[model samples]
Target: MAISQEISYRLERLILDGGLAPEQKIPSERQLAARLRVSRSVIREALHELQGRGVIETRHGKGSFVSTMVPGSGDLREQGPLMHLFEGHPRTLYDLLEVREQLEGQAACLAAQRATSLDRHRITKAFRALEETDPLSNARPDHGFHQAIVEASHNPILVHVLNSLKNMMLMTVQASVANLNPRAEMRKKIVLQHRQLYDAIISGRPASAQKLAMAHVRFVSKSMRDLELEGSTLIRVPVEQEAAVSHQNAQD
Candidate 1:
């Protein structure tokens, strides 16, 4: 197979196998060329092929990305939802993150106020599953944990809205995760944020829960932006002092 074809195949597998999420931007051609040890022309050719196959797409200047509407992704559309419009755009996944921040923050606050013992149990279980999941596992139980939180809100409309947005959110998560090397020190920060959010919700602290949830989303959004600027799949993780402080507070 030609090198470009090979690159296309490898990237296709990343998409189909859940390594790359829909609507999530791929690394730039220069980055891909360097990573794959190929020329920029080869990377462009491979990206073009992926775009033709509907496995990925390229925005005018934003670079190429996996398609949010790929056949195997289930119920996703190229442009059916409001959120998908931002897909492959230049915002670096922030558009989707903004929607999520609004929706999920409310969900978390409501869950704090409204969750029954049983709902809390389910949410806790889901959080456990998410915690145990390998961070590199793309976006599986992460969505599950958040979905559980939404359900715990006891608001049918919020649950419905969250459910509706999940497809696009999944794509966003895939893209954000693509650049995260889970073994890095930033793992503590991720763990700290999620754990704090879970604790706040389960403890019936609506204000705390809402704040924590939004903070988590914003962190992910910023990370996506940083990854895009660097033009590489390997994202650099900075040690967050706040995360350490939060961890100690949690312990107390």
Candidate 2:
């Protein structure tokens, strides 16, 4: 990693570990530079990274302070039990689903062209297991299936993008499943749709796999929106609106 990245990583860790609290001021530029034994420029670069992540805020002539309730500011470094992901905004989730569909569709196409026998075996096993389990228990394994496809593509950049997308997909699925209308039978249909995607992947048909993956993602996205509309009183979506807001999940 570059020097700036190394510094940013450490500073982010400090924020995640609760060394810094919301609205609390951080060390001044010179103080930080002295403490870290780095030049002021390096400190500035690191501070900029923290700001981008929504962990800190800068005020004109007042130095930098920790931002409380910032987007993606929660402690994500520590792996724990399932974090509560309340229902996301209908439009925002819809948009994210679209982005994911575009990325994963490309990933599926690449995987079809490049996947080795071992990659095929792993994806097949994951799909088979997903088919046998309940939706709630199968969410992570379902993630594994998608992740395997990205890895099989042999493109590091695509792998990174898909890796980052996995968390939101998992959280969205969990929320959608939990908020589903039992009478509508959305969950069962969703599982079946996923099965179709898996089948297409196994067949080594890139175009078919891509199409199926897109339909499956859009299906879940629409389901979540439908649930929000029908049962708006029960779901807990965020009121704050920001274009391209981070979900604060660490899985990415």
Candidate 3:
């Protein structure tokens, strides 16, 4: 193979193997040449080839970034209508959680079975960040931890589908965290669940990882439902009290 072709092939493998995450900036030509002991011209040529194939994108003044395999927000407006629906009906958040239960459970199972050393390191880092974050403000970190697990699955299609649903997932996570944060007991249970899930993945227990992940999401779903029900009951109590008072005055 030509030197440029070989270089392009190696770079493509890096992206496909999850070494270069979607939208992550690639090393500059100079950096790549130095790291690979190649001439800058060759590196540039390879980058150009990858760009042609839509595997990498170059920003005018910035640098090259790995292109997302699936269309992102910039290239696709399909998620717009779905976002509107999620916002209009709060119940859709439960639907989103149900989807999460399946995808996340599978992701965890795969991660336990296939996570490389580097993948484990990233997952550990994300888990620590989540643990350190305040429960009330940990939505982003929580989502990041789950995303790391999904990426560790090393299933390109799974990673891409979850990435495409990034907005919806974060929305559900934010709602779940916000509602559960105020309840100290629920917060403690969630923290314990995360720890158990992380341990299962790190220990290479696929079955345990899948079970723990699904249970965690289900617990969140149940908590959200309970909160909603409590809120509705609280709302009804005031109305009922007003009705009873008015009725008594009429009877008097």
Candidate 4:
């Protein structure tokens, strides 16, 4: 396969398999090229193709993002467990975070009350791994650490809900790091809040853990809102793209 085609296929798999989720911003062309050991031009070609197919969207200052794929590219019927998704809505992505704040706070409270010795150990290990790292450098691990908290909660329903929304969670993580990493003070505050949340969960402080979880999610919500107000240059979306199967990515 041609280099650009190979990259395009690779990204397609990620989106289809949910490695990339709707509204999740992807790496910059330069960063993607670096990761794939290819030229920026190759990455650019793949991205434009992805864009044309309605599998992704690009904003001039914000970089590319995984959106809903083109019709016939995949099956996305809203049935069974995911019926609530319906047609999906990117503008309401923030609504998920608002729900996550409440749901995850309850998870933290459950973890604080019910976590066994091993669960506490795992939660601590996960949190510690994320504690000091630069948020911009590795968002996946940061995302994993938070997932660990839900696991520690020992509640199957909570775990299932969070797992179903994993892609969205990672998207939020990407957005958080993208916006906050450039601001030293805010980044530090985020890390500190994460640490405090971890401490509360592991130390068996249910109320504190719940409070911290709510606060942390609220901070993430505010950060995204702040970014929207910044008004970065926008990439012009081509009009002839394939019909998208789900929500459109929010563009400038």
Question: Global lDDT of each model?
Answer: 0.72, 0.69, 0.78, 0.72
* Runs in model 1 lying further than 4 Å from the true structure: 1-84, 169-173, 181-183, 234-252
Tens digit of lDDT per residue, candidate 2, span 129-176? Answer: 767766545545666777788888889998887665565444443344
Q: lDDT tens string, model 3, 1-252? A: 889999999988888788889999988889999998989999999999998777899997799999987233254334455666654466776776688788889999999999999999999999999899986677778878988999999999998876655544453333567667667998899999999999999999999999999999899778877878877421111111123222110000
User: lDDT score, residue 213, model 2?
Assistant: 75
Taking all chains together, each candidate's TM-score versus the true structure is 0.56, 0.56, 0.56, 0.56
Per the 3 Å backbone cut-off, how many clashing residue pairs does candidate 4 have? 1
- Residues 1-252 of candidate 4 have per-residue lDDT tens digits of 899998999898888788877888899999998988999999999999888677899999998888855434574442344323322443455677788888889998998999899888888787777765655554655666777788888889999887666444433223556556557887778778888988898889999999999898888777777666676421212222343325322210
Residue-level error in angstroms, candidate 2, position 93: 2.3
For model 2, what is the error of residue 12's alpha carbon versus the real structure, in angstroms, after optimal superposition?
A: 22
lDDT of 2 at 198: 72
lDDT of 1 by residue, 1-252 (tens): 899999889889888998988788899889988988989999899889888677887898888878877856464333444544544455634665688888789989999999999999999898888778776663556667887888888899888876656544443333454355363766677778889999999889999999998888788777667766778763222222223221110000
Clashes of each: 0, 1, 0, 1
Clash pairs (backbone) in predicted model 1: none
Model 4 gets an lDDT of 0.72
The candidate scoring highest on lDDT is: 3
